[model samples]
Target chain A: MSERLEEICSIELPTGESVGVHRRRFTGGLGPHVAIVAGIRGDTPEGTRVAHAVARHLSTHHERLCGTVDVYPCVNPLAAHHGARHWPGFDLDLNRRFPGRADGHAPDRVARTLLDATRAADMVIELRGAHPAFREETQAHVRHDQPVALERALRANVRVVWRRSAELQGTGTLAAELPGLICLEGGVGNRLTDGVGLELCDGVLNLLVVAGVLPEDALPFHWAAIQRPLVATDEDIVRVRATRGGLFLPSGRMWGEVEVGTPLGEVVDPIAGETLEMITAPVAGRVLAMREQPVVYPGSLVARLVAT
Target chain B: MSVVFRLEAPYRGEYALHRLTFGGNGPAAVAMVAGLHGNEVNGIQALNLVAGMLRVMRPKRPVHLLPCVNSIGADEARKRWPFDDRDINAAFPGDPEGAPVERIAAAVMDATDAELCIDVHSGATTVREHPHARVPLSGPELEHARAMMLPVVWRRRGDRYEGGLVGAWRGAGREALQVRGGRGLALDMDDATTLARGLVRLLAHLGLISHQDTGTPSHDTDHVQDYRSMAGGFFVPEVQTGERVVSGKLLGLVRNPLGGEPIEEIRAHKAGMVLAVRVYPMVHAQELVVRIAEDAT
Candidate 1:
């Protein structure tokens, strides 16, 4: 097995500064090809960490690799450069420009190039970033219609495998363009969370094993050590929103169990120092995500629960 | 001027959407909105100019002017709402009981009820736009836009107005158009005056005001072509917006900033008026450098 670093494309800025989006390719004996992409958003550093962690492991076990595995540590280098959600000057969200125009602007061209590069892979896994306002449990998301993707995500070492509605993915998203794509996201946006990188890294290795890119015996840990994730459909997940506008104090623990009416959080007036409303769980489930940014408007999402 | 709507903001005093009214109240001759985007100062300026003109004159019918909708954003030099960073324009036909932006959008919708509605805007901070009216290819809107006699009358497809305030008004069975000029975050007096003149012309055309028509006729066309840089480089434009150019005119040059090497030369394709020009030099690949409103002939 041999590994080669390849540049997908180089983008020249107005200052004649050139930056390249790169991928590390590990090629072994011919078999199924798997691609791991991360950092579509600059704020999602957790995904970037997980992408590199998996690449480091792949480098050590290249001899045992059965096929080719491509790891794109960070796709949007420009956004990542500024730690911003959107491209700096354009203020355009890169994730929303997928299957983009080849002859169009930088973001569109890069989107088109990335989409074309990964479309033919046997398995494509996207490492997504958490919304900056929320701290999420390690989770896997796939389209509800994609049973194969749903089944594959079960071993992703996540707390929940959310099979979302078609429309929920939104148009112009990476998941919408790529059929049978599995998206993994965790931690807080822009900040790295402890244990998330390790867990997701292990999950990727396990996925590669499932995809025949690596042998089961080559996994650093036993296959049985992986978490048995909860497979949830769109209907099973309920979004908890604040009824009153205030600063939210999250009381729910990540992946913690809950019964109906359990206290999840409270909304407090920032100026008056008074409690406005107490948010409680409406279903018997586990806390999947919690808003960490505190500021909330009426109808603002405070948390999400995956009903058991 | 009166506060048409208000939202209780926890941190700030409160978010107020104000409206300036003119003439006796009945069905309005027209409704004009500006500063939907906080940084688009030209819109705010043009609307204020119109208000000044209307204050002394008695209109046959009522006319409404919203000078600065996103006042908080304008105060902070941000394009969106300061606290949440949400675009107010996107929340059109919005819910009164929804988010702050949504409620503000709903209020604007409720307040801007008129025979004809015009949403005014400025180009982005990085680009300067000439005063122009964007209307449908063929409608009462196109005719009204013609009456404005702005520098350019851009006829666009209906689908293009599917999102913003203009779309919301059109969806409610009202004729709507957009008037844009100058650049965001800065004021250009000439472009603002041009926009104000166009609004005054529209009022005269509607018999709401007995104003004189003195502005030049607009370059009417449906062919507004955008020229994008093939590569990222420092762009130096040679022509100012509102300037006329014949076929194959040298418009701009994309130059390497590190060394003084020229990477690409951009030129006009046909006879037209420059509708927009990139102001900020630093740009990425494929970014819009210029937009031309091609002559009808």
Candidate 2:
């Protein structure tokens, strides 16, 4: 079976130029339709990389695929072109313009088109990267009420499966629109990390296997290679914030175990190099994320730990 | 001028919140603040003008003036904090130990201990708004806005003040209102003067200062209609801010970016004063081009 590549949305620039957002579709002996979307925010290149990797694997095993799989590699192409978090000229976050207006601006039109195109899919998987300020460990997030999504996310081969509450999900996000949407996020924003891409690509493939979009025999890696993730609730996550405006020097590693009061980082005066504040763990847990950039204002999130 | 709050900025000098007080401390205290959005120069100028007036007038009760809260942002002509791009106004009832903006917000909230508080602002960069007061449909704030007697009095719903400094002040059970004029990143001396006069009128209404003529009464209304561009183009506005127009009046024309003919001509749907007009020519689809506070039929 051959693959089909189609233009999902076209964005018009002020200079009379147009950029096309495309989707790659692979159909075998139709079992279930799954949509894998990425690059809603241009800064999240990790998602785009994983999307292409999954697309490449699907292309190679198109003949043995059990169902239809649609890969939206990059939705906000103009923003992706310049590596910006928002649409270049408008400064609008495409992710926030969901279930958008048909007759609205270019960003809103693209959002509406993408939401319309993926509404029919049985499963929708959104890929994202960590915030630009931090480096996060591999994780899958599902709405707390969605048991099927939670169950599917557990098989995504991530280190943590977070069942987040509706209040914490934020407004206008893709997951807010699609209740059962599974979100996979990790690594650094804008820049792809070593092994992170491969790990996420493998995870997407594994999810495809579980969804019956591809046969288990078609997976590139052994099933045993998948990590059994620690399921966590919203309360299990502890956000560690800086108390002083300074440079945050991280002392803890991502996913590293720590006891209560463990020194997570030390905020130092950038000029004098004097220790302004020593950040410590509040609970015995594993560090899920660590701030990479040094500069921090008071109350800046320096690190996040998942309580065991 | 006395420093009410201070915070150590990382690489720069310390951030200080300066308060200019007039009259001795008393039971009747009124606080007025501006420049929460650094780019909004009109409010800053208005407060400064008010400050100039207050320097000579002997007030019966205490009056506090916070002219420019976001001095750092004002220096760079940016609306948000230069470091984090966070809106200081949004961090209201803020964290004293939070970010720089949050600390400033908290300091502002703490400093504003008064019977009535006023937060002043300006229109967005792309548009120029007539000097006006935005208040609730029926409340003390509306009466206070009428006392200011600016060109326009926009009586809106209570829920509209659910966020920002005005909301935070209201949440604290204080009589708070918002006043705005001109445009951000630019100065309109006339509009600033109008705003200053209106503020003084409010002081006179409160019996803090001797009564003086401010200006003509504002066009009071509760119906504000917004006209948005249907397509991305160069919007050429036909009407200016504060101009009155009837329905079917040509408000603006959206011309194609290229040398083509006008793509769309937007017309007024209601008879009212033009509260706002898009000054910037380049516009995106659904961007506000004009706003009219429709007169009740």
Candidate 3:
């Protein structure tokens, strides 16, 4: 069986140049169709990299694969090209335009097209990177109500499996549009993180196996190589915010365990270089995410922790 | 005029939210706000014009005008708060104990407690809009919009007003409506003045002021059509906002950017008043080139 690259939607620029959102499909015998989508936001290159990595593996093993696997490498190419979070000219967040209109703007049409293409699949997997301002540990996020997604996320190679409640699922988000969608996210935004891409690629391949789209023996790595992720609910997560406006210097390491009162970071006066505030861990947990951007404001989120 | 809310800034001195008051101190009849999006200069100019008019003809009831709510945003000509880059308008009915924008939003809610409230805005920077009031299809809001007698009164679904300052006010049980004109970044003085006149007319209709200015009735309709480009190119609009168009009128032309060859000609299918037109020439495929508020059939 040969792999096929299909164009789902085309974005035409004013210069008569065109960019297309594509899907790479791998089909063998008829089985569950699993959709792997990435790069909804331009800033998240890690997700796009993972999508391609998975695509490359599927391409190499297309003859051995069962069922169908559709991988959308990068949805928002324009934003990805400029390394920005939103579409450049429109300055609109593609993530917020889910279930978009058929006759709307460029972003809206792409969003609508993406939803239509992926909605019919048996399983949909969304790949994402943390916000550019923060560096995050590998995690799989599934809606709390979705037991099947939660069950599938357990097999996804990641540090933590966060089950976000219905209330936490913001309106207009892709997660809100698809109930059983499993969102695999990790690493820093824009720039790819070491080992993160490999873990996610392995995870996607494992999912293909779990969905019966790919044969278990076809996976390059053993299924046992997948890490057992900690299952966390909304209550298990803690968000730490800064109390002062200054430059934040993170003292904690990524995925490092912390005790109560452990020094997470310090906020210093940007100009005077004086310590304005010392940020301490409020609970005993592991650092889930840390703000890499130096600038800080009162109530600005600096870190997120998952209580052990 | 007085400071309604204040926040201590780390680098800059204290941030102040000011309100210009007119007439008696009794329960305010109306509270008008603008510049929630700092780059939208038309609303700021319109409110300022209203403020200027209110100064001379003292309204019988108290009126509050909070012009340029996001002063920091206006300073940098940004839509969101400068410090955190968060939309202040989105943080409506906000928390005083929460983020900076949230605190400001909460303050705005408290300070603008009135029987009626209005949030003014301008179209996106790339599009130009005529002065219009967007209200529900029916109810007191529609009646009030009709009283404004602006160039256009577009009846929109209540669901569309789910998250902004207008939504917050409506949620709090205050009668609220939104009016917009011109475009962001640059001030179209004519449109701004037109919006101001409409507001003045509404105040007079409410018996809040003694002045009687019967502004021309609007082209009222709930049905509006947006014309989008089928292909990407340099869009040349044939009509301006507020211009009346007939069937088969050449609304715009999409021409190749490099060469002068015309790609597509957009024509109006039915007669209507132009509600919005794209000011920026360069357009992507499916981009909104024109919006027409059709006459009721």
What C-alpha RMSD separates each model from the true structure? 2.4, 2.5, 2.0
Clashing residue pairs in candidate 3 (N, C-alpha, C atoms within 3 angstroms):
none
Reproduced native contacts, each prediction: 0.62, 0.30, 0.58
For candidate 3, give the lDDT of residue B185.
Answer: 92
lDDT of 3 by residue, A1-308 (tens): 66899999988889999899899988887789899999999989999999999999888888887788889989999999988888889989898899998887789999999999888888999999988888999999999999999989999999999999966878787888999999999888888999999999999899888888888999999999999999999999998988777789999999999999999999988878899899999999999999998787677789999998
- Model 1 residue runs over 4 Å out of place are A233-235, A282-284, B23-29, B58-62, B96-99, B113-115, B259-261
Question: What DockQ would candidate 1 receive versus the native complex?
Answer: 0.54
lDDT of each: 0.90, 0.90, 0.91
Clashes of 3: 0
lDDT of 1 by residue, B1-297 (tens): 899987656566567889988998788778999998999999999998899899888788889999899998999998988767789998899987676788889999999999899999999999999999999999899999999999999999989999889999999988999999999999999999999989989998998888886877789999999998888888999999999988899999998877868999999999899999999988788899999999887
Runs in model 3 deviating more than 4 A are B7-14
The second chain of candidate 3 has a TM-score of: 0.98
- Displacement of residue A3 (Cα, Å) in model 1 is 1.2
**Per-model TM-score versus the true fold:** 0.93, 0.92, 0.95
Model 3, docking class: medium
Q: After superposition, how far is residue B285 of candidate 3 from its true place, in Å?
A: 2.2
Residue B286, candidate 3: C-alpha displacement in angstroms: 2.1
- Most accurate candidate by TM-score: 3
* Minimal lDDT window, size 10, model 3 chain A: A293-302
